[model samples]
Target: MPHLNGVTVHPDCRHFRGDIPCRPNKEYGYQCQDCPVYAPTQQRILIIKLGAIGDVIRTTPLLRRLRQEYPNARITWLTLTPAILPQSGGWIDEVLKLELTSVLHLQQREFDLLFNLDKDKEACALLGSIRAHQKFGYQLHPQYGVAWPVGELANHKYLTGVFDELSQQNQKPYVQEIFELCGYEFQHEEYVFDTHDDKGYDWSQLPQGRPRIGLNTGCGDRWTTRLWSDEKWITLINQLQQAGYAPVLLGGEAEAERNQRLHAATGAAYLGTFPLPQFINLMHQMDGIVTQVTMAMHISIALRKPTILMNNIFNPYEFDLYGRGQIVQPDKQCVCFYRGSCKLGPTSCMEDLSAEKVFEAVRVSVPLA
Candidate 1:
């Protein structure tokens, strides 16, 4: 572990000074500020996390607990603009988009503490400007800024476990942990979307009666991890419709061509023509979701709606933290862990994942039948 020039790890930092505020207030049922777990000092803190959608979702509990720990203190989160504010809901008091070059100017306003959820070199360098009383994250890369070597992160451990280790000096805020760290329970509430009413959606055009199920055929940027085949998707859509489900297709503009192909192939309802928010609106109206390890999965988790995650490039062990779904892994024992591309062309993990198997998992999760 590297060490920051002037920073030291406070091994004896305790949690919960027991200054909890009243529960069920006018704003939040329980205002996080009243919790005694926050530090006794009034300090301005900043949390940094920049990654894919799911990684950001896993950090919610940490942010919530931090707020509870220091209700009187100011907490600002550093992340992409898209992942902040409107999408963030009240997780952090403020969000500072990570624009290092531009933030160089704001370095004049110092921070009392800096928390790093990601360890990119560029991001760490930017933290050098802010005068943080306490700096937390992986040790800087050799010649960078801070040098505090946190422990190695295990791939097998859930997302919560990895973050728990980073904040171990404080408290593990996961709701499912053995010890109640923050003295407050973490609840997975429905994703609160503030619709500005500036969008248009044709809800009346959607078929009525049967449960709505969203089918996702595309994976993330990485194609090797996708386990579902187009043919299988077509088969699944047919099976779902026959089994009394109103299957709807969901994806981004990047999926336009694939969505068109799938629509032509299976004749299922394609809602990709609408804008992104409109697509989200449709997702919100749906009864359930079926997808791979993509952003849609995170939305479904926040929705607390029953979901079925098809493990494509990764396994259930990689993303089992945000529960509320059945993870469908590959049947082939040949490649246990996701090995880049299959030695024999496209791996069967995703392609071989049968619609029948998926439908079974769906039935078990949502009980469509």
Candidate 2:
């Protein structure tokens, strides 16, 4: 064993770790001073986007722009759902879960730039506490104790979030708004999703020779107003089957029972629920996706799957399908805009969104062989 000197360590190297040997040394036995692959950290960027998983997936597009702007930056993303974020070998050098340990670590570290995209109180408060030379997006207002826009760029998003009427009138998609928040122009940068292709998930059970269409049946529990009737899903499934496409029921544990019933009723393929990575792999098999404005919709967009997005309560313009999908809404406008439950007793505008319209969109999106 040889004695190591403080001068021998390259602390600014992107791969440098004080507590353990870096990857270059571990694999090739190269000391930090002689490491051929050593890349110095140009900038340290911290992004706080504690999420609803869908937002986390959509926020991935920002990573591309960030990489382009700061090629050698060591980007650290602090999020509630770390699992949903891109893993190693991606733009993000570190994915820290929003917990006490991560909070403490972040407090001690300094960043060249900090972006707190989320308006949540905790997220804003964290942004306030962090030591960053420059900050963008929202921050906790010291006087108001509420999240407020840090700069003029963030004002548009902030106003839209606070005022429903403004949101309704806004035509800018989510990706553009986030890009503007960071003072960058939106160039239709694609999402950086970790498809877990290396996992080698066997999806042979799925029917072949026909275009596989994924029908994500759940809109999540928070927004029950977005839920479509079983009759509509069944109708769409039957229509897809008749139109020479394979309709595959997709959902998580919350939708397991409903998906099972849909499968039994229409005899469409239902492969069952899976963990996030596995579920994403299953969705990867689809030629197209039909879903409400839920996590599945974001995932579908990330996967570049042609999608038919059903909307009722939220602004259709809020979503950017990357031109791969179309938004289908009810004939009658929803009275429950931005609502969790239908205001109209025992009926919803989602009922007016005909299954035929969705089927037609699917046919156009993923046409027959």
Candidate 3:
């Protein structure tokens, strides 16, 4: 992960001194009350989380809650156009795509409240421009505004305690607190992307109603650790086909080589290099998702699709559970959890997980064929 640089704090900076009426109040950390950007009951709110698909997935539940709290409020999610695309819903009236070109122009909107989800220095600096009445996010480290600074939860007892600080009450239900802080109420059911169409793939080429299974063979750069070897994936898909399940290869151009290799090995269904929205729709068509630990896994969870996540170093406890998948770990416990790459040669943890084991796990977790 990239550490925060001095770019977070410019030399000619506007510091949040308590003396300035517009300065953020420190009593509630950056949850300012007297600041010119401190209006809690505004009719309009702006939410910011500009990158990382997983982070975007996690931040979405907060949107539902924000809607529940203020039904009449016009809520907008301001996110980088490429990194995320929020769905139109009861909670969000509009998704304002935050292109780099218009970031400075945000000052004109005069938003009621702004929640900075990504805490990057670039985002912090940009917040200086939004004419919001309230600004809520992490307190800048004495050095880098809010660049991953140790926050109010530095002395936290449990992992959940960290999220508690940003919320209204820690003891409340998890989803409830998440909504309350985002200023909305939430429905407990997971979110699912509508996937009714055949997507843009050459679906007409394949037989109709084939018992298809989806395979996500690659994770984005951040989650390369969870990626299984091409050899192992090919082996597993072939085994599934022998048992009568028609396996379908799925991925973006990023995983085109891996998908081709697997398809060659199995002579199975393949949806290669389609547009993202169409690819996602195709994924939804499959019986279930077999993937590495990535945003697709989270998407599968939200869709309530049975998913098996092949993990090399990820802990099952750390994530919301996926019903039938096995988590592969090294015989020797891993030292890195949230940071650093697996330095061990060949990544013994995942490489050791045999095709038979993965196949059996998937079979039991998902109805065979």
TM-scores for candidates 1 onward, in order: 0.72, 0.97, 0.71
Off by over 4 Å in 2: 1-7
Candidate 2 lDDT over residue span 1-369, tens digit each = 223665477788888777898888898898876679888899999999997999988988899999999999999999999999888664888889999999998999999999999999999999989999999999988988998999798999999999999999999999899999988999999999988888999898999999999999998878888899999999999999888999999999999999999999998999988999999989999999999999999999999999899999998888988889689999997888899878887777899999999998998888787
Say which candidate scores most in TM-score: 2
Q: After the best TM-score superposition of candidate 3, give how far the Cα of residue 367 lies from its true spot, in angstroms.
A: 1.5
lDDT of each candidate versus the true structure: 0.60, 0.91, 0.59
lDDT of 1 at 275: 57
Q: What is the lDDT of residue 204 in candidate 3?
A: 63
For candidate 2, the TM-score is 0.97
**RMSD of each predicted structure:** 10.4, 1.9, 12.7
1 or 2, which is superior by TM-score? Answer: 2
* Order of the predicted models by TM-score, top scorer first: 2, 1, 3
